[model samples]
Target chain A: MIGVELRLMLRRRRVWLCWVLLCALPTLVAILLATTRLAPPPGRGGAFLSAVVSNGQIFPAAALALVIPIFLPITVAIVAGDTVAGEASAGTLRYLLVRPVGRVRLLWAKLISVAAFVLLAVLFVTLVSYVVGVLAFGFGPDASIGGAGAIPSLSGVELTPLDVVGRTAATVGYLALCMLALGAVGLFFSTLTDSPLAATLGVLAFVVASAALQPLDAAAAIEPYLPTSHWLAWIDLYRDPILWTNLREGVLVQLGYVVIAFGAAWANFSTKDVTT
Target chain B: MIVATSGLTKRFGRVTAVDGVSLQVQEGVRFGLLGPNGSGKTTLVRMLLGLVHATSGSIEVLGEPMPRRARTVLPRVGALVEGPAAWDHLSGRANLRLLDAAGPGRARHRRRRVDAVLEQVGLGGVDRRPVKAYSLGMRQRLGIAAALLREPELLLLDEPTNGLDPRGIQEMRALLTSLNEAGTTVVLSSHLLTEVEALCTHVGVMDRGRLALSSELGALRTPTGRVLVRSPEPDAVVGLLDGQVVDRRGDTLTVRGAEPAALNARLVSGGVRVTGLTEERRTLEQVVLELTGTGNDRVDRRPREAVVPGRSRGAGGPR
Candidate 1:
């Protein structure tokens, strides 16, 4: 079942379209930055955008920040929301159920497929931006500051290229987990309705509502628990001595959402009548 | 028995879709479940396939309880419910291969199994065109091919020939008959009486969510004990038969109280030229119409009663 779901996902032209669009946004940003050479002043614009003009190694982090706010979530919601509801609307849900694919197994396969999409999207954006970043602004001239070739962290500490690579890998893993939590929420909505559009809209509404409430002082008591609150915690990965506080809290919160949302999906889907 | 359901009922909120339908299908017989539209035939089939859970009742397929043992039982049973459905973006062959891979089958045999079913369903020359490009008849054949991929012991089809042309329908009937002959019990649900009449050995009629009648096709169509006679001299034949002539239309008379052979002899002996003489048996259409009520799709308002000035006033007003 997992193999079938993965093949179906990879075979779709829409999945590839999503990857292209995701990579396109950062590449477009790279072009403007390379031509203008005008990096936003510190504490303005997307995180790491002010730093990308000097160190190309930090471009992946900057690119991730560019898409994470809206583009990444929208694409994740589209794919995840279509998981069960798309099949239902197409009238193939009943056939799969009768094919003797257990409901639990089908949900698991869908979760894995959604996770794969998230990983692929995140990885493509990072790799494309990395190449674009290096070409637009060659490896930084600050190699003499620390050992051989080193880049400055968010702090004044100069870190080697190897350290930057390791931190970017950690950043990739963290962002994937955050998107997966959103994917689980989308999966739950997918099981609630037979219309894929409706399910996708529901997930968007959820993200929008959560993000809308995050900045309000009135919502401060429940701030840390919101699904979107921990999404930006990956920025701390660039600290000289990694800031584990928000990173650890972010991992725990995202894991909580994944468990709860997935549990709800399994509970609802296993008992659905599959009338379609 | 291939399938047995006792007190099977399903309710969708306020509407009862299937009500107390106890059905039995014998092994090795082509069972046709006949009903009008919205008479619960689709719901019953979905329940049997475990696509829709029953509100209350029990269903047994192939001697094992349904849904509970569905994983073990369903692989041996193939079905096409409501109509055919497939991923419109993929070719018929690709769709079959993917569905075949979804179950417990071995990977090496998937190609052979898919090809065999496609050939069986008359799509041997099919190309790589996606299902979205296939005509309705081609799509229906593809659906059947998917069902046949597992070589199941029992085949449950709902309106199997829905989108087929005349020749396609005939080919489907022949295919099902040959499958039954090879020890596969076939169960099909259809609203088309002619399709069932030509294909089924046993019949079950559904009316308003209830099983109205079930019996062998040959048994429900027993001789009606009336003989039809056609003679050139209608007046002489009617006069000769007298009280035995139940009905008359031109030169043809429906006569009772005599066998076809005896009636023919009497007509010939009476100096009447008998063109045709045959016993009248009940047709499947007649039996079905007699047993079932009007299809649920129809709605008729009751006639208002005329009110006298002195009678109760409420009864005459518009409802």
Candidate 2:
């Protein structure tokens, strides 16, 4: 069922359009940084921008940083939101339920498909950035930067080729999990309503809402638990000592959401009346 | 009984959609659930299929309790709920393929089975088109093909001809009848009396969330026409009759399950002078309306008012 759903989801022109949007962001960042060499203001994508200016190999890290706030989460929201609500609104959920698939099993298939979408979306952005970076800026030994280190020559150094590849994989894998947590949120909301647009917006709202809360001093105590809080923690992967504290917290938080969100989704969906 | 529900009720908030409907559909019979638009036919069907949870009461399908053992029973019983609902983005064949995958496992012949069902529903060559592009009739056919994909022993269809053209309706009737003859017990709900009259052997008519009547189609179709008599003493005349009177006016009444000679003799003996006597063979629609009280508003007036039917009365349909 998951395989079948994935195939169906992938066939949609909307899905392909989302993929294009995801891949385009990183490619744009690479193209702009490669041509202009103008430094992004100190706080933003500066570290990644500087890294890209120095070595093409570091562009994937830069791309992941640039898009974590909006583009990637939005793409995930659309796919995950459509998981169950789309089927219900289309009037096909009843047919699927009437088949041998149990509601629990069907829920699992939808979750898996959403998680798969997250994986594909995140990987596409990273790969596009890497390819464009290599072609334009030129590849070499990669740069290593600490968490919160998006500036050039400021707490940044070079790394071996193997380290660059390995770190890039870990960065993407970790970010994918964070996006999967968001996907689970969308899936849970999908089960709650028959409007796919509403579910997608709800998930997007979570990401935006959490990120917006980051500016509040009082909200800091509750900040670490938010899915957005640790998104940039992936930059730790490029550090020399490889800081795993924030990365570990990020993984655990994502996994925690993955479990709770899915458990909630199943609880609601398994016994849910197929009214749509 | 292949399908049975005892005191099955479902209430949507303040409205009781299905009020204690206990239905029994016999095996090897084409059963029709007749009702107006919001008569709870769809709700009852949903409960039977475990698509909607019953507020109370038990439902047994094919000798097994439902919404509990639904996983075990549903795969064996196919259904087209409400109307044709399919994945519009998918090709008809692709939609069936996915549904069949979720159905009983027949790994190798799955493609062949899909092909056969598409051909059976007359979607054969056109099934490869995206469902979005298919006409309503084609979508309905695809829905039927999906339901028939598993070779289910029992098929539950809700308003199957809702979106079909006349030709499509005929083809659907023929398809279902042939399938029923092939030993599939069919339980269908429809407002299309013509289709039900032509296809169903038994029926359960629903009105205002209640079963107004349930019996064999033969029992429902009484060859005897209703006895209408106009008399000055209407109360005295009604008091003289023993059988149920279908409709009543100031000096006129239509009596059912009655005899003209006996009624006339009874009225005359009772000294109730009558102005007119006639036997009107009521159509099935009139019988349904009278029995169901769907014509309650007009039926209330005691004069010769046009009992304009077809439009719903005080009680509104489901939103």
Candidate 3:
């Protein structure tokens, strides 16, 4: 089942198009930063902007952070949303089920494929950005800088190349893990409806609502647990003597959500009528 | 028995799609599910395949309980439900290859199996063409190819010839006949009575979620047809004939059971004018129409059931 999904997803021309666009965005942005003397206005991705202009090597890290809250998650949600609903809508879910595959196994295959897609998407964007950053700008020590408050809670921190490398890996891993939970939400919604677009948009709507509510104190009590709230916790990984607090919390929270959300999906799908 | 369902029921809210449908399909028999639209034909097939859970009762497939044991049983059964469905972007062969990969069994020799099915379905030459380019008939054939991949012991097809042209329909009929002859129990749901007559050895007739009749073809079909006579005094002729006259038109009469030669002689001796005399056998289509009280076109509402004669072959088979 996983093999079938992989073949179906990877062979689609649009998937490749998405990859090109995702990878190209950061590279183009990095090139623009390296060539221009203009600095982004303060307090709005400014620190990451300054870091990108200072050293090409920091481009990958900056790009990954820039897209973490929105672009990467949206892409992941689209693929994940389409996994089950697309098949159902196309009237293929009936055939797939009649393959006699256990419902849980089918759901697991879908989850794994979405997770694979998320991993590749993030890696592609980060890898291409790193290469572009190195080509456009010179590689060397990156600024002890990132988006504002990336490490504001901590001080007296310094990093060598190896430290930066290690922290960056941790950050990427954190981002990937968080995205998996997001993908699970998408999958959950996929089981509820036969329209992939509707499922994806439903996940996006939740993300948007979470982001919309973040600034308001009224929603704060539940805000911390929202996927949007933990989405950027990887920023803490960049701090030397890396702050493990929110990163660990974020991991636990995301993993918890994955379990509950995926459990609900499996419960609903296992006995679903499969009318399509 | 390959399949035996007792009191199987499925209710979609207020509408009971399948109601206490107790049916059976024998091993190595060509069984056809005959019903009018919305009479639970598709729903019954879906339940048998475990696509739709039964609301009550039990279904056993190949000696293994259905749905509960569907996972194990399905791997040994092939099905084409509600016409053909395939990935439009993939070539016909690619689509089959993907399904074959997902089906139970070793991947080895699957390539040869695909080739054989494609050839069998007359799609060997066009297997490379993307499914989006296929005509409806071609796609239907592809669906059949997918079902045949595992060489399953049972084949379930619902309206398999819905989109096929005359030639394609004939090919499908021939394919199904050959498959049954080779000992694969075949179950198909269709309104094409002729197709069922030509292909099935046994039939289960349903109406409004109830089985009106299920029996061997030979049992349902009478031994002889009636003598149709055209006469100006048709109603008068009804009185003259001692045997029962089944139907009457403005100038014609259909007399059943009585030999045509005897009826003609009686009519001539009775001084009745007979313009035309011909023997017309009762067709499977005629039987279904009379049973369901429906003509050719499908009707959404389940017509009231007709009390058809003949007992169903034992919950399994005549044997």
A204-245, model 2: which lDDT tens digit per residue?
888889988987898989888988888888887777778889
TM-score for each of the candidates: 0.95, 0.85, 0.87
Model 2, CA-based lDDT: 0.83
* Model 2: per-residue Cα lDDT at residue A117: 81
Any runs in candidate 1 off by more than 4 Å, and if so which? A143-149, B242-251, B301-319
Error of 3 at B306 (Å): 28
> Alpha carbon lDDT of residue A74, candidate 2?
88
The most accurate candidate by TM-score is: 1
Q: What is the C-alpha lDDT profile of model 1 across B18-131, one tens digit per residue?
A: 999999999999999998888999999999999899999999999999979999999999999989999999999999998988887689878888999999999988999999
- Worst 10-residue stretch by lDDT in candidate 2 chain A? A146-155
What TM-score against the true chain A does chain A of each candidate get? 0.97, 0.92, 0.90
How many Å off is the CA of B276 in candidate 3?
11
Residue A196 lDDT in candidate 3: 93
Query: Which regions of candidate 2 are displaced past 4 Å?
Result: A41-46, A141-154, B225-282, B294-319
lDDT of each: 0.92, 0.83, 0.81
Candidate 3 off by > 4 Å: A141-158, B223-225, B229-257, B264-279, B293-319
lDDT of 2 by residue, B88-122 (tens): 88889888888888655766888899899999988
